[model samples]
Target: MSTKRYCYSCDLKNDSKLIAEYKAYHAAGNAWPEITKSIKDAGIVDMQIYLTGNRMFMIMEVDETFDPVKKAELDAINPKVQEWENLMWNYQQELPWAKDGEKWIPLEKVFQL
Candidate 1:
């Protein structure tokens, strides 16, 4: 099946120790099972996050069943998802232009060749 791709970015606290801990949490099989299950249940087939300095970029590929609105709704009702977000808040910061409560700000695509 074909998938759609989305990109987003967020910033990390400028503390090296926090960055290291964040990286460790995202290491292979280290993410909370609840969080992983929630992502798969949301129709996200694949996702990757990359870090440079204190900035993070994420790429996500989702199946046709995926809907961002529905995903957000689902997350809003899931305690585990809320827990993960709250915990991650310790290491993450909203983009300068992000609205209140926004963490990962979607990136507009440009110059694709």
Candidate 2:
């Protein structure tokens, strides 16, 4: 079975306090179990999020059958997932060029060796 990787990015509210709070929530032993389970249940094989200043880069490795659209639809109906996303939105913001409702915009592949 082959896996596919996707890269996405978003911005965090640029306040240092808020950024620190966000990082604290993501620190070892601090991650929410429900949120992590939801991710895996959506057919994600693995996921990592990196932060520099207020910018966030997320890399998701998903199973061959993963459907982001379907996953989103499911999330919409899951109260726990919706709560998690709403809590996260407190520290996140759309990229400058993103459409109104967009977050974690997919990045273009510009280089490969």
Error of 2 at 63 (Å): 0.9
Count of backbone collisions within predicted model 1: 0
Off by over 4 Å in 1: none
Report how far off residue 29 is in candidate 2 (Å): 2.8
TM-score of each: 0.98, 0.95
Per-residue alpha-carbon lDDT of model 2 for 53-88, expressed as tens digits? 899999999997789999989989999888878898
Judged by TM-score, which candidate is best?
1
In candidate 2, clashing pairs total 0
- In candidate 2, which residue ranges exceed 4 Å CA deviation? none
**Cα RMSD, each candidate:** 0.6, 1.0
Residue pairs of candidate 2 with colliding backbone atoms: none
